[model samples]
Target: MTTLTLRGLRTASRFQRVQPHPLLGLQSQFLVPQTPSFRYASTTSALPTRTPRTFPVNGPSTTLPAPLNVPARGENQSLVPYLYSVGKSYLAFYKTGVWNIYTNFKLSREVQRKIDAQNASTFSAAVVSASLTRSDLQLLVRNWHDIKRVPMFALVLLICGEFTPLVVIAISSIVPWTCRIPKQVESDRRKLEQRRSASFRELTTEPPTEAGVEKLAKTQLMHINKSLGLSFGMWDWVGGLPTGILRRKVSRRVEYLELDDGLIRKAGGIQHMELEEVKMALVERGVDVLSKGEAQLKGHLNAWLLSREKAPVEKLLLTRPSVWPVRMNAPEKV
Candidate 1:
């Protein structure tokens, strides 16, 4: 039994020696050596380094295109003349007020009704007068009540009304020297004038080429159309009386010339047509022919131009069949 046990033990020891312990072999392969002979070097230090890179930024361009137009000084003239205009308008209003009073006294239905009512009440005239006085007192009380309800608002309005005239006078006196045209407005006005002047120069100096004529005509037409759009009537003038009059007389005149340029372009070249032929041509193109003859054409044309210039493009495009490119391209006349 001892011999068999010894043989088994020896056999086990020989098997263990042949296998050489799998875990011990793995640890020997993987475990880091702590010996000084096994020093580590950094992988990053052996690799080449790169310089820091930068990109350039873009900036706004300094050079700008020159302005196309410059407005005349006359176009942006001082407000001093406007002050005089205001004074004239005030006088006109005062006169109109007096006329209104006279008209009311003579023609008002309310006034007539009052007179009839008083006449009908002849027997109780004294009582009626006393009642009227009492009613006026009541009206005053009601108004006082209203004023007291919004005391702050009433005070502001009273102060404004009391001081308005004095303020206006002060402003007008100071405005002439102190107030200049705003830079933006002045710049815009100058640009407009420059454009108009350029157009005028082209019309006068350049030979009657179709392109030149067409360009001028279009420019003028646009101006005239704009002016007509902005046109105001008598009511607008009357409404604006309390403020500086909002008349566009100067602008209208400029636009009128523009309209004339368009008309002239339509009637062949300026050099091609006689004055009479031009008038006839204008009449043909919806301009009202004055019965008073050629002498009155200017005044008539001005009025007619205002009416004609309104929705000029729409009228041309919609009503005039021959003016259309499709019609123009047709073999037969439209």
Candidate 2:
């Protein structure tokens, strides 16, 4: 077993002694200790300050915590360095993903389900316990999605050769999350904005009344489903979405939004939200923020939060309630 001690891993030959990874630094807190003995002292700093962790790797079979997602390469960076840097990052990201899945493969369905349920806790508790931010978990899942697209990337590299970047630029959606250029992100956002623009119009039509269900319930529901990027199962274009499926999908989406709202609030509310986060939240709510400045985005998000956080219950209703207002599936707040 190779044990890596974070505090004093100055040198290692063939990983024979404790050492920092070539790619990962000593300060990387993304990989939490698997052993119960090495628990987080605080979410702000997941690793214990005084004690050193012994990160054991049992060949390639070992599963460590997932790596941090590759952050977007800076805009000023030339294309060559951008490609080179992300290539290394993706290699590390992919290896850890395979190892992670391999370790999980041994679990029984019940155990797996329980683990998953535990993982689905409100961010207030989960951020401290799991040592992973909500975005980290999302990126971790996205990495798995990218794993399946390996063949597609390999094919492009083979056929296009030196022109692979051009091919990738053309088909940017298929590019891995870690490897997406700024152009691709803008392209993807523009596409999502189109759908969100339509859905946002429908979602905000009636202003989430407390008295009863809004008008044109089915049409609004379809738009809600579209905004969430939900799968339209058991419905045809002629019949539109079935009421049963529509209610379930919208409810599930609200539940997820509830979780996200708590996470953002816990992360110190809209004022503390970074520029990228502000953009993302606005876009999700169906605002076109392509040309908006950071200050303007925050103002919009603040307004969104006030309306969303205060009246979550009314927004959750899918049908005319016998009662005046519906109960919200509230997430635990910090």
Candidate 3:
């Protein structure tokens, strides 16, 4: 047995010498130092990265141009479609000029109604005179002559400034006499004038009270705003206008040689006037000084003026009504 064991050990030793030990078999390839396969294993450092690009979104997703209804540029575009584009919107139109016909016509009607209702017995003489160009008046005279006024009645009118002859003749000839002034149009012309003068006294001559002026201002502002496409708490039109006639179209008492440049410049550039300022100017210009709310309006106005230290009004006061007719005390007295 000892001989057999010795022979086996010698055989194993020969086998080990021929090959490597089993424990080193796995690392045998490493001992040979085989080159790394570039195909399977990359040694290059990782790249600094970013997300991949994406395509832009498709149709109608684009933003719309401002003042949407404005005509798109090009030959095919619609003609200056809205007042907004031209900045001729209702508020700008009416608050500025004859636009009141478009904007404040209803309000004027309401105010007139209120006046008529309040002064049912008063005779109102609204003497609105339009200066006629010589050529136009001549044309009108020619037209009148062609209409065949009775010679006697025309003579009477020319001599006495008597409209009665014209009225009577027109009443007789008219298909319906719709345009003729009403005969016996009950009026207290003197009384209304007195009242108007009184109202003015109550407002201007007296110490300030907010009742008259404020009411006038508020009502006028409300109407003007509504006419111009705005209202209380609504100033949306300030930014721009939408499609349509921006203001009610009306014939203006005032004349202008041109629409875009002539009168607009004289009235103060539309761009230069803010909406509130426009309202104030309109009320100040159009309204009669004797309206009922003038006292109240004058009060606030006086306060504002006094606050601003406007000229001619050294100081203002709001004395109680018991002072019989209201009066203003000097600032020193106050």
Best model number under lDDT: 2
Candidate closer to the true structure by lDDT (higher is better), 1 or 2: 2
**Which stretches of model 2 miss by more than 4 angstroms?**
1-28, 31-132, 135-137, 140-158, 168-172, 198-207, 210-216, 228-249, 313-334
How do the predictions measure up, each by TM-score? Answer: 0.16, 0.50, 0.16
What TM-score does structure 2 among the candidates reach? 0.50
State the C-alpha lDDT per candidate: 0.28, 0.45, 0.24
In angstroms, the error of model 2 at 155 is 4.1
Taking all chains together, the TM-score of candidate 3 against the true structure is 0.16
True-structure RMSD for candidate 3: 42.1
> In model 3, which runs have C-alpha deviations exceeding 4 angstroms?
1-69, 72-103, 119-275, 278-304, 308-334
lDDT of 2 at 185: 66
Evaluated at residue 285, the lDDT of candidate 3 is 24
- Go through the candidates in order and give the C-alpha RMSD of each one to the true structure: 45.8, 13.1, 42.1
If ranked by lDDT, best first, what sequence of candidates would result? Answer: 2, 1, 3
Worst 10 residues of 3 by lDDT: 57-66
lDDT tens per residue, model 1, 161-262: 423223434222221111111232234334433433443343322222232212333334433322232222233334322211112322333333343334
